[model samples]
Target: MNRPAALAVLLLLAVSAGCTDTGPERTTLMVIPAGSLLYPLEDIEAAFESQHPDIDVRIEGHGSIQAIRQVTDLRREVDVVAVADASLIPDMMYRPMPEGDGNYTDWYIAFAENEVVIAYTGKSIGADEITQDNWYRILSRPDVRVGFSNPMLDACGYRALMVTALAEEYCEEPGLFEAIIGGSFDPPLQVDRTDGVAEITLPELMRPAGDKVAIRDGSIYLLSLLDAGGIDYAFEYRSVAEDHGLLWIDLPPEINLGFAEHADDYQKVHVTLGFRRFQSIGSERIGLPIVYAMTIPADAPHPDEARMFVDFVLECFQDGWPKSGTATVADKQIFR
Candidate 1:
């Protein structure tokens, strides 16, 4: 009606229009993950974003320990952390998140599963002669090289050592690890003895045998190595080997540590490490069914969106990856 009132209404309408056109910005997510899960997570990311077009998902892969460190030590910004070792979240981060989040990380969800395997090409030294029975002896050959992950860095590396130790007992051989791993490993840092156990010392470097042993951060990091013939054999997860089309020798559950029933027996062999130099995780390493863990930290950038991504991952794992014209459940077939 009046000129002043008309002008006020017009200004209000313009401001409202600006707000409506912009809407709220899409949420950006950052996921720090264990290296082994890189490829699969890439698949999950694509599918996740397709399902939630408004959200943007990005991932950074590293050793599970390093993933934790990005939050704990390095102080990098991460919305969600998914680890190969579930215990790390509780052991490392439970104390630091926001209040009411006790001394240990409480919201951990374990999904899927895997067992250890020795994957090799047909050209691998003594590949044919190697069996579940004589495998350790074959890998130990002075001429044969072995590959493993860094125990202090990756779970698979530490698991490899534990599995080798278990194989010693299961095979009824006393000096198996020494004869096999000791020859190629950088020990005295972690010494191999005639006794069933080998002493593991930090700051020690294990070298490869010419071109035989090859070490990588995550088991999946060896895919290119295997393809390029950089190394003869590697210690990897059964699921990874299957995912990459590599032939793998399945160790028995007694040694594979995939079965829950053998938890006590599997716990026999352990590896200790000086994590922060102030404390040591003594005798903590053990071979167990590989169950990856996931959680959102208290300081996440987009926590609500991160939770949604994690939920989608769990759903994909349970429902299995979608394929051409069918819904296929992995049912351990992913590792077959």
Candidate 2:
């Protein structure tokens, strides 16, 4: 151990430490996805961050509409947006930005599909008795508490309304929507039928008349309530129920909004959002097969990083996440 060699080693260590301390900062990619995507995306985020150590991924979940409103209305600068409804990207984000020359987003990729279901627990009232044949009747009982997301915010919320309305035709039981949902609201969520179509309008503010119905901002939030015995049943996505390991009964294909072949049948029911703010964007949400989509906003602060993350997410889906029943990959096409 010579003195000159020791001095050289100390100087080299100091330079190495200086270089490590001044490395480039990681880029933050902000993602706002549908509430239903929170769990899966958390897994995706872990994998993505592991592969790209220089990028930090942050995800926030909201009801599909609220997720878009966070950008389009609230003007939050987000890097990526993924929603349960593919049409919403065009429906809400295709318009011109308030302060920008271009629309919030010009395009998005439809990547996944989901279906609605009635989720319950073993502790749920009449859980042992509820079946596909008479689940609605069980939910309509006076002592049962039914929960759903806000129709004004979540895609699952409006789909719940559609499922019940469509059930009338599927089950040949008239007024089922009123029995399970409409009559439970304070102002009475009513249905207007015309030209072979059933339309339900939701007020700007919806409050349950009593304990019969519980409403949350997002469908995923109802999972906690269902677990805590706060609500006996909840209208949830099949994926959410399966993801959380809850018991859920599959509704008829005609009303589940899962099959693309049943798209025409699903269209018989429509939900109109009556909020004043929605008027500018058009509030009528026509029924369609549930499809999930994602996009990087035009004003995204980290478009390059967002694109890479989107690619990674799509790859994960293609690898077989749909097999879990969360959602089926819509198409095999990759984002370019």
Candidate 3:
């Protein structure tokens, strides 16, 4: 081979190696969202990535509390944080960072809403006979197994406790909470009443006394248990149940925590986390209408990308891009 031809061949090999090493430069945007948002966010991620080939969106799902803690407590370099409960942003993230100059997050937008429901499969113990009106009674059966997320970790877990307590008054059935939930734990989840308000105290470790109750880190984890027939029924978000195509009995507006008009009624129940980690923030969690929210952390590594992603999500909600089955988008006015 001639010298010029040999040099050309060597140059081509070097160029090909460079191209393979760096074909496209992509900026990664890290997102931590509540477990319930996993499916919908996956759809969003696909659409967003297609539109912005230069940006890669990475998502990790955890219980809303743990999702925020990944930033505020663990000091992870998360760009965006979303949660199932709107109040958690202020309750857990509004405080000043342990080593930073500002709060973990300064602002959050409430984007969607959801309701708690009992999800079960054909194999559920009372699947043939359970109804919204008698769900608590059915769950109380000694032979039945019930599942919920850990209250100290997931918003839905605490909401499940609240719903059961509220059902007593709404269904005119006394001791329903105790019959189904309270009495199933080892130390027992205890409830105290003052006037019309019911405050439920959760033990640090909510251990099930027997095979009657199953608890996981996030509500989404319960879906697999329901599918495997590990639990007769599971308390899940209506959006999650619908997304997974599971059968669910919708509770009344007052107990479902989905209706803003029932906000005052929902406020009658509260959950107090007994974990020492929550002592700094005051562990009491008041029941409110379920609202989904998101924010960019103050110390986010990719602030510009985080803002763009948040705007994209809000626009999707406004345009009904998440679809109806995942969760109900908040009013269009809120997005404006």
Candidate 4:
């Protein structure tokens, strides 16, 4: 064999090898979750990915309602959805969906619990003196600014209002609810006492008229503003407050939406989202134990991977929740 013949043969062999060496394609799993679960999910994603290197997990955080709507309404691709409110999974995504081909999800597992509270920084007005008993009063001051998520969009928003209504009864303050939330949003919210429960009727448009209430799309969005003094205090999840290192006032069990034992009391204050997403078929979100739920959508692109991930998350919550500022041991995590 001559040198030229040998060179041509070698080149041909290299090209053949390159064409035959097809490596495995990486599988991508898309997860849309509540902003409140961002940190914990990040940890979960890291751990899950380490154990399963072939799978690539991508996550986006939004309000729980908005998160579900991304798949059901916006037609975005998602494999898994984890929401702060478990009921949202059924109420917003269940049967009679926008697609009309049955529900977006048939079931979900409730895996974690959180509490609602008033979170603030040292720079906040009356931060040195504000206590669980005095948070509402401090919020009502003429110069103080408060922040909360949009009820039309985020669970925390409506939960904030529920906490206020509950506070009114617990403190024996007749007009406390009106003083804080009413003065914040435009066309003041109306209170309809039905069967001893104060059902708050929210306006179709959530327009924040004055600077009194800094309303954002999600609760996590307010953390930066709170830290920068753009707003004094924000209504946020207890996990969020703890994770962000903010000074928070823990509301009573009845108002915090934390204790499952107080679910009946928590149900007394509900908020109706009559926004466009509801489209006249509004979901009257009654308070319940602050449970987080996750489900692989019926139309998921990667149901198997999603199921595996959900299982991993449940196990993580059972073993790692306390360190993550989440509660799961004391019947806090009701696995469904």
Candidate 5:
């Protein structure tokens, strides 16, 4: 081959190698979210990424508490944080850091609402005859295995405990909470009335007794167990159950923690976490309508991208709660 032709061939090879050496770089937007929000967040991620190709969104799901702790306690770098409970941001993330690292977040927007329900499958124990009235009894049976998230790490866990405690009143069954979860955990659930108000105590570590009650890190983890016949029933968000196409029974609004009208009744019961993590300082979590919230942390590395994504999510939710089966919160609930 001629010298000029050989030089052209070598130059072409170099250009081709350079083109294939690395793909186009993209700005990453990290999202730390509650486990219950996983499926819906995934849908949102796809939609968001398609519209904003230059920005890549990454989602990491954990229990609501653990999700926020990933930012506040662990000081992990996250662009956006979405949680199952709207109140968690203020309870755990709004305070100033102990080491003078500033606050994790000053504000959050409450976007969606959900209700608690019993998720089961065709293969679940007593699937054919499990009614709302018989659910408590069925779950209490030795042959049945119940599953719930860890209250120390997830909001659904405490909410499940609240549901059982409320059921004792709604169903006119005394000691129902004790019957289902009393001796299951390490410290167990404690309830006592003082000053005409009922207070519940949750242990630092929730180690369930044997296989009777399966306690996982997040509520979403129990869905697989239910599908595999490893568990008879799991207490979970109604949206999650519906999203997964699992068979579920809706509880009354009073105990379901889904309605604003019953907010006062729901507030009658409160849960106190045993472990103190971050800025929460053992605050009591009062029951109310289940509202989901999201925020861009103050220390977020990708602040602009995070804000854009958060706004997109809020708009998506406002335009009829999109992908997620949860209901949109009132306009007043949105902070930014």
Candidate 6:
């Protein structure tokens, strides 16, 4: 009887321990991502939690630059970092990857692709005139309002300029960049040309020649404005536009920086900016198939759980990349 009672007590203790509510002891996941990925990340989070009822997920959205800062500057304990700018993981985190040595971020997986576009609500000024053939003309209108992300903080910001520069090559209009982006200032003006190319000073924000361009931390950050009709059109990525259900004009791949073949042409207009703690982010903007890169941070609280979350993201990338339903992770990578 004494042995049976002891056994029963032990069994009761084990059952009580299992039933105790000390808050879940399961590891939680923290993911920082480009603002554009909010939607896909939502789907992933729901699926992840459902699969592993014990794990908790916390996701934060910011511009790619901001996301990098969460680790590099803010020193936040981010389990995983995903950015629309795949090269950023290599450029910013590469030194940390080799770990014990000086590798900041190693072996990131490029899992998704996107393209640039002019996203807008139909209420945009001269919506009737904003065709692919003459989108610039409409954007040049003083009443038209356009916006882009701050190049210093967002990939879309730099990509917007790349698109603007490429637009000149496509349209053969010499003053287009100056007129469209350079001209969108509080005090509008004409540019003086020198040595064939015109030079104009812009606010660090790079306002459009007219009041036409609006800038933000990330392209998707403008979604609310577009929805509320506070602003007209904005430079955004195709994935962002589709995800938000905003009307958009699809820029040609050559100008949109979506095709890998035009990488050389896209690299012509390089931008170096000061964002985050870096002394300066001096990366040449190249037009390759837009791919997103993700990595698990070295000091994530839930390293194993974060790895599980990363697996889910890679799975999503396998399908969601290229906006296609199916593509291998290797296919999505631009510089593997």
Question: Which one wins on lDDT?
Answer: 2
Clash pairs (backbone) in predicted model 3? none
Give the whole-model CA lDDT for all candidates, comma-separated: 0.66, 0.81, 0.79, 0.78, 0.77, 0.68
Worst ten in a row by lDDT for model 1: 320-329
Q: Supply the global lDDT for candidate 5.
A: 0.77
| lDDT, candidate 3, 31-136, per-residue tens | 9998888877765676566556677899998878788888876889999998888888888887888885788876788877788889999999999999976788
* Per-residue lDDT over 40-62 for candidate 5, one digit per residue giving the tens place of the 0 to 100 score: 66657766666666788999987
In lDDT terms, how accurate is model 2? 0.81
| Least accurate 10 contiguous residues by lDDT in model 3 | 319-328
Q: Quote the positional error of residue 249 for candidate 2 in Å.
A: 0.5
Q: By TM-score, highest first, what's the ranking?
A: 2, 3, 4, 5, 6, 1
Q: Give the TM-score of candidate 5.
A: 0.82
Clashes of each: 6, 0, 0, 0, 0, 21
Report the error of model 1 at residue 257, Å. Answer: 2.6
Rank list by lDDT: 2, 3, 4, 5, 6, 1
- Measured against the true structure, the TM-scores of the candidates, in listed sequence, are 0.77, 0.86, 0.85, 0.83, 0.82, 0.79
Error of 2 at 161 (Å): 0.8
Which ten-residue region of model 4 has the weakest summed lDDT? Answer: 1-10
lDDT digits (tens) for residues 234-305 of candidate 1: 888776776677787878788775665676766666666535432423335654556677887777778888
lDDT of 4 by residue, 172-248 (tens): 88888778778666677767777899989888777768788788887667998997898999998887887778889
Q: After aligning candidate 3 to the native by TM-score, how far in Å is the CA of 118 from where it should be?
A: 0.5
